[model samples]
Target chain A: MTKRVAIIASNGGLFDAYKVFNIATAAAATDQEVDIFFTFEGLNLIHKEANKQLPMPEGKEHFADGFAKANVPSISELAAIAQEMGVKFIGCQMTMDVMGLEKEDFVDGIEVGGAVTFLEFAKDADVTLTF
Target chain B: MENLKANVILDAKGLACPMPIVKTKKAMNSLEAGQVLEVQATDKGSKADMKAWAESTGHHYLGTIEEGEVLKHYLRKSSKDEASEKKHPNVINNEELEKKMEANENIVIIDVREAAEYAFNHIPNALSIPLGELKERINELNKQVETFVVCRTGNRSDLAAQKLAAHGFANVINVVPGMSGWIGKTTGINK
Candidate 1:
């Protein structure tokens, strides 16, 4: 059975980016349709400006560094990879306004909307994740 | 039955972040303003990224519906085209981007890795702008220069370059292999 997975991102740190990318990628690999909604702080993940400066975790050489050092795609790269593999990326509209960012702050290829928009999509999802 | 005109069927199945949007943007770009691009995908993170992408970029979200595992994204292109009127090439490869950087005398290099990674080792003259702080500090850099953004490998930088280009930073570039491919001298992070 095909399952629909929705991941909610609220963290923008490297660890957060790593986790979000990994989970989303895994879902795509399993042939499950995936949708990621970045909200609040999570919006930072997609914020073209903010996403660049996320902090690396302290004393941890987990996924983020390993991915970078090993030449594996980083979260953003994985985002594109996931897309290539079949994943959807969305940014919360309400969050964008709340954060006082204009449309120019995001990357070129993204869709932006609010909770109403997200819930409309999430309502039918088989798996919804809030990370 | 769902009205085909109202339904947005975006094929982001084989693409990621900017690609989904890049595909959608292209679909929307060719259309008359106000036309909607419906996107479908399996990347769970796209759920939010799509909406945010729309909002900031002046697009409208009609809705998202799940058909089996695929989530359908409905987006409407905004009528406003004043700031984003110019059409940019949709797809850019690494070699093409590299040649441009090599030719440019004032390319701004950005490193999205942590300060430690940067301290431990980084490309020479690369600006250390961790992803988390990129937004707040992006303006600090001069947009007029050809900006080259990179992460540990190439993912974050790819996204960063796309983000910069999307925001009208016309001369931005993404470095593939990032610091991982730095053939020059290396630095170490002291803890």
Candidate 2:
């Protein structure tokens, strides 16, 4: 049976990045339906400019550098991979306005919205979360 | 009778934290503010996750309904009055930021690695809290200043970021690569 899941996000921290893909990928792997909602800081992660700038963590800079050195995809790239594999992307309108980003600022594939819009999405979700 | 309009439903299943949010953001943008957006997902953490997103981002959560095994979410766009009030999305790149806290400031660094790995070496002023324990001890974090998360690599730290972001931590940073890339001298481990 298909399960509905909703994820709410506002932070673009490295750990959060991991969570973003981990949860989405796992859900896909498990054959459940998933929906992701990006808001506040979380919107930055989906923005083309900010997403590209995700840095090497304090302690793990080497690993990231090594991956970059090896030409392996960065975390964002991996995220794209997951998206291609089947994760939907959404951007919060209020967040976009405060950041001064337009639909153009985001990557090629993303949806934008406001609170009531997201609530409608969340209302029927079997699982929902705010990240 | 209520008017019914077609909404673009995006299936974000088999994905993780930021991806869900990312996809939702995209779908909402493609839609008219007053239209409905239905998202189907399977992440166990989606319940409260969507609610908070709805509240902070200006979406009206119509409510949720469980059908068989799958759950469905219903949300509506804000009226023009509510739509004008915009908010910002805070995205912090661990590798991109250089944070320095003042002495006695409230800053916590979480090493989301195995105890053995953390015991070997970690950054100064960092706490060893594996990612597995994060959910249970999330309240330990201070929402005020800065809370940095790290792992052997960047993978786990991203997980930490998702949990902390969802839990409403205002200032959080996820260090890329985690301890594996720490260039400075390590504070000797518990060993």
Candidate 3:
């Protein structure tokens, strides 16, 4: 049976973006249905402009070189792979409203919805996680 | 081992978790079913992760070979016929299998999951014949015995059961919702 995985992404740091995309893409690769909901600061992950400005959290910038050395995909590249793999991306509408952002600010192929919309999908998910 | 050739060779060396799998999935999408893919990776965990990922996706994980620091993982893409979600005509739930075990009924239980998966936990006394090796090892089993086939879920076991039936093994039953839903007695390395 194919399992459904639902993830709530609430952070948008460089490492956090990697964590979200890693889990999302891995689950999608294994034939599992996956949905990622970006809320609060996590919206930056899907924001076309904000995503390009993803900063290494505080003093952890030194690890970026190691990540590059390890051939870790950039945040935008992982996001593109996740999109191609059919991992559904949902941006929180409430967050966008609070941040004065519009749908045009996000990358293509993402659904904008509120908490209830995400809960509808997450309630019956086989695995529900927050990052 | 020297003569084994893959239709495609993916170099994932220096990549960590998810990159290897992500690239493998992309490459697999371009190949025809039954074609083999060889992935070269330096990540130590790729061996087990590749096996688990392939098994769950209905692909054939042909095991891994290590050369120096690089692990070479071979996987055969599943054919459309196999991925059509075919189920064996004869089936039993996990509970029925557990009951039979509790009653001490003489039956053969074959676990078709990868060795790594089986090593974690499996029904006691279940034979570990992975689906990829089932055809070659078919002769080792008695065709007369009542056999129950299982995997992490039921997909691989369904395919294994069909293969057994085709090989003239009668009384073969696929245990649906296999070990994933099994609440029976299990003994393995993790236990």
Candidate 4:
């Protein structure tokens, strides 16, 4: 049976972004339905331009070469794969409003929703996680 | 094992978590059901994770063979017949099962999810019999006992229940929306 996995992403650092996408893609790979709600700094992960500039957390730059050597997929690459795998990406509407952002600022296929909308989906989810 | 052949080979070596699974999922999509996929990965976790992912997705995890630092995981895409959800005739809901447990009913609950999943959280006293190992382990179960089969969802337990019924277990019941919807108490290694 397909299980629903709901994730709340509120961090935009490299590590956090990987965590969110990794879990999302893995869940999706297992034929699980996945929805990721991006709020606060996490909204940058879905931003058309901001996502490309995701940086490793302070003092963790040394891991960049190691990550590249290990052939880790870029954040954008993983996000694209997650999208292709049908992982739903939802940008928090309230955060967008508070930050003076618009739908055009996010990547295509992103659904803008508020907490209520996210909760509606999460309430029925088999697994609810935060990153 | 030497004679086994895969229709497609996916090189996921040097990749980290989610990449192996992501690439495998994409590769599996192109193959016809029942076709085999061999994934080569250097990630230490790929063996167990790949098997759990394949089984949970209705695919058959053939096995993994390690060659030095690389692990080759074999999986067979599930045929249409196995992919489709088939419920057993005898059924019970999670609520009903919880009620039975609360009442201290003398019943056997067999969890058919992977060992990792069961280790994280499972019903107390629920026997761990992963669906892949059910046939060989079926003898461990008493046919006379009233057994309830469960998994993350009803899909796997449904198949397990059918298998139990076919094996002449008369009172096997499948718990629908199994552990995913279970709100009752659970005990596992993670706890």
Q: For every candidate, what share of the true interface contacts is present?
A: 0.00, 0.04, 0.92, 0.96
DockQ preference between candidates 2 and 4, better one: 4
Put down candidate 4 lDDT per residue, B1-191, tens digits, no spaces.
23345678999998888789988988999998656788999999898898789778878775677788998887877767544666689999999999988887667999987654565568988988878789999989999888999986688899999999999999999998888789998886425
Point out the higher-scoring one by DockQ: 3 or 4.
3
Candidates 1 and 3: which is better by lDDT?
3
Worst 10 residues of 3 chain A by lDDT: A68-77
**lDDT-superior candidate, 2 or 3:** 3
TM for candidate 1 is: 0.38
User: How do the residues A7-96 of candidate 2 rate in per-residue lDDT, one tens digit apiece?
Assistant: 887788665766776677556533456667888878767777787776555777667655444333356775676677566777888878
- Real interface contacts reproduced by model 4, as a fraction: 0.96
Task: Please give the DockQ score of every candidate, comma-separated.
Answer: 0.02, 0.03, 0.58, 0.56
Ranking by DockQ: 3, 4, 2, 1
Model 1's lDDT to the true fold?
0.66
TM-score rank order: 3, 4, 1, 2
Question: What TM-score does candidate 4 get on C-alpha atoms?
Answer: 0.65
Scoring only the second chain, what is candidate 1's TM-score? Answer: 0.45
lDDT of 2 by residue, B1-191 (tens): 11223366778665545455556766777877556677676654565666666665666655454555455556655545431321223334444433443334456778876443454467766787776678888877777767778765566677677788888888777776556566644664232
> Which scores better on TM-score, 1 or 2?
1
Interface RMSD list for the candidates: 11.1, 10.7, 1.1, 1.1
